[model samples]
Target: MNKTNSFRKTIIIASLIFGMLFGAGNLIFPVHLGQLAGKNWLAASSGFLISSGLLPLMALIAISITHSHGIFELAKPIGKKYALIFLVLTHATLGPLFATPRTATVPYTIGIAPLLPGNMQKVGLLIFSAIFFGIVFFLSATEAKITDLIGKILNPVFLLLLFLIFFLAFSNPMGAAKDAAFTASYAHNAFTNGFLEGYNTMDCLAALAFGITVITSICSLGFKREKDVAITTVKSGMFGIFAIAIIYVCLIWLGATSLHDFKLSSNGGTALAQISHHYLGTAGDALIAALTTITCITTVMGLVVAFAQDFHKRFPKISYKTFLAINCLLSFIIANMGLDTIISWSTPVLMLLYPLAISLVILGILSPLYKNDPVVYKITTALTLIPALFDMINTLPEVLRSTPLIQAILSYAERYLPMFHLGFSWLTFSLAGLIIGLIIHFVKQFNYSAVED
Candidate 1:
């Protein structure tokens, strides 16, 4: 392709990536982080960007470098059984269990729920989600032009609307971000809190799930060589993630500054609603509603389609449409639990899955060094698994967490694990695992070479 054509194609791919990754959590979490981090928003944003922005970009690059077809293949070095388990868990989290459901509830929470009478909020969510998923099901079942639909059309509109909000917020300030008071959680370890908060975006997880589609999209654009595809993937992914990072910074800033006029919100969704209304009044509410709905629909459609297609491939006996129906129905049911409940429940799952996902991304990227050895993958994953389980147990619901068994386990972890209170006890374990795995792989390699000589 010529320079102009290549640039155009890169822009198109970048838009597709941005649309796929920038969904419910992407919109909400950073804003909430800003509210909590307050004067520490800049420091918090650095950690948030590392997890949410940098990790996702690395994941895409990892997928391209490994030349894996999907998450299953990206994880295959860990062994087939482990790969299958990881696949199921990853998809389940991204599908009906959390992300897909959040798509419906987030838009409802930010848009429609506020409009309804207090008692009517429950029924309103029910009606709105039903309608929302109905549309998702129909579009996914039909296998519509989802890429073009989102990239060429909806994403641009969403960005325009979002930037308008940003423009207004900056032009007519709610308050200065530096002067905003820090919340209790952020008062101590704001960066760590922000790092943990980035898990809410789930973009790292989504990058693995969505990586193949992005590669395939690049291939379809006439990039025949693997080298060319990887290069384009990096180029396009950088553009996309850079855009997302900017938005995250803006949203976090918005959250911090809004503290001048409003108290800290329960969640980012509420903060966003308040900010939008503050800037634009009733029209702002409508603008936010439209923006969220557009973004959410694009997201849910991608999730449902991905789930059905992946599951149908795994079980040929079941049809894609049947899986599609199952996903939408389940998501609709879960979404009615309300946004806060969904977020609360998702924390434990993300806690468990993120270490695995991050390790996998790192492993894939470094596979070239280890020559894709299974022993390394196995040992690293096994050690990481122990700390991940502990993290999940620690983050469980208050009732379950307060139980004797759970409390005892948590107490042990806190005493023994570094950074236990900071929600990153997994970092030390994961690093140790990686180093030990590499040492084992090299020792085995040295022994074999010596014997051969």
Candidate 2:
């Protein structure tokens, strides 16, 4: 009986993790990558998996290994002020600012809009998003049952529908993959493009923010000890990562083979809908709609619950229910801004924030190598900030993108920063900072040991 309970708990937590990560990006991005990659689909999928798969798993593992209470704990080595800032920024990014809103917008665009008549599309979206976020608000307002609600109920329904679609697609493929030319970026460097594409999902950022929630869920499941919580977190995260990897590869395969019959699409969501319509007709369409809606709902609920809990802890007077209501309200308003606009505007923020989040995760994992020295964390994060800020500037809107100052900065970075053109200028700076940090750490250790002797 105890073994059975533990097994069930593992499955529940894993499903919850998968639901958190598998938003519209999981459903759409791999398919789009496969389409653009053409014959190089495998290479592209590998890159995508590295970013979307390995990076997120690493972030979760870092959380578990470090036993971080949350993003605040994860960033505390940098300092209290910076930790608060990082936590706020991460929460905002994963909450009302982008991820949560995108959940509502993505489903409306891909699932509902296509079904609506041209004249009714706008109204349809408003109605659909209203209902979507309404459900999110309802589910998240009461946080006690959230883990079970997502893991036991919503996730299984989502998986069943998703597996059905995948089975149909794989069993009777849309068509064979033809010798089509790769898209412009994919033609030269499909892998890197695919790698960066995963950033848009922002799952790594979500993982950092969700760390506390996962720990709480584990504790609620009777794993009260810190060590047990960490161990369970890693084990549960593995199940989610495994599910993501399988689904992504299959979706990419579906997209790659789709080129034989369907035209290349602007985004993965559209490609998925089109393919579904072609293969299963109305039933396929219903499946896609249900999948999008459920996936988006799960994501929104996860973020809403996380954000509410974090804020309520920080500001005890606010109450979790109020925080949940505020976030849902904000998400609903932003989501109604339309999917394309939200996505376009999100690019700059994602560019800037991704490096910082990645740097923290890497530092957390490597902290043991440097003996968990705060100096290492501080310097490495500072160095990472420079290139990430410049990258952010470069991704600005056209009006600000071509100014002389911005162009000059970009030019200078391109000339001196390794991998600047490939969107990893942070890599060179991080390594330099890590080395400097190690030197400082070892010198301090040596001096201390000599004095003791």
Candidate 3:
């Protein structure tokens, strides 16, 4: 009886963690991708999965493997100051500089925008957001009894609402798919675009940040062992992703089918909300709006907690309460800008961050395989950053472009790397770095002396 109860409890804990990772952005983006990708949804989705699914799961695995404080501490092999820079960069990626504010704006766009009178929509958004962020401020200000209950209840309610919504879309698709937006290049181009798109979802970054929380939750339930904790986290992640996978397929297909009736949407958010309002009617729009807001709030809360926790670690003098207050104020401000803009700027940041993120996971996985050597971390990270920097530069606006270095690197990447012409521009360049590092590691190892000879 005792053993059976323990196993059941473990399952529940695992499921909740999975749910936490699968929130607002997760729902919004993939469905939108489906609409654009159409019959090509599968290929595009596979691209989405690389960042959305694989990269994040791997980040958690890296956390478990290192059992370190965060990405900053984990990268101590490099040096402390360098690690802090990585930490600041990651927090900025997830928070005020980009994603954090978007969290607030996204739900507003999806949930509230449709119901308003055409001329009043913008005004309604501004008013609605002020109230929304105020609530975030209050709930975040003090983790009260009500907040705990609300958090627990959100998962089940959100799931129920989503299940109901998707059911409607699947049983009665808006219409058949119209035409692929970028057909010839859609399949191959998808992975890179998907990779870039993954940033907007923000899970890969969140995975590293939230890994400790997952481990702690598992431990609270009386389990220990980093390896076991990691296994559990991965298992839960897979379960959540099971939901993500199904949802993405249906939503993208819905988006594609929507096109026969509607023109090509500017992007996913428009396509999703427009399709929902069209098929599901006024009530459906309201339901989506409410649900999107709920999901986004929870994610925003998670990021808040993470930021506060980091601050507490570095400055013990300032209590968690102080940090929470500060975070809420900042997030409230960021959230007001609206979701559309937040997502726009996140792309270039992803080009900068994704390679380093992939590097951490790859390095962590290969750490044991290589005996956690200083040289491997140093060399591989250096090589990986080169192309990542190049890719970031290649992706920027012309006036925003710095010097000729970016142009020089882009020309070189095109010449040497595979798929460069096809638009795996980012990953192709990274591959060049990966290859160079591996070759150097092998060649250098053999030259080391086995004896004093």
lDDT of 1 by residue, 379-439 (tens): 8898888989999999998979999999999999999988888888888888998999999
Q: For model 1, state the Cα shift of residue 447 in Å.
A: 1.5
Model 1's TM-score against the true structure: 0.97
Give the candidate number with the greatest TM-score: 1
The runs of at least 3 residues in candidate 3 whose Cα sits more than 4 Å from the true structure, single-residue gaps closed, are 1-3, 115-126, 141-151, 176-188, 397-449
> In candidate 3, residue 242 scores what lDDT?
66
Clashing pairs in 1: none
Cα lDDT of model 2 by residue, 338-441, tens digit: 88778777888888888988889998888778878999999989999999988888788877888999899889988988888888888789888888988999
Off by over 4 Å in 1: 142-144
Evaluated against the true structure, the overall lDDT of model 2 is: 0.85
Worst ten-residue run, lDDT, model 1?
A: 138-147
lDDT of 3: 0.68
Deviating ranges (above 4 Å) for candidate 2: 178-180
- Best of the candidates, lDDT: 1
Per-prediction TM-score to the true structure, in the order listed: 0.97, 0.96, 0.87
Q: Candidate 2, 40: how far from true, in Å?
A: 0.9
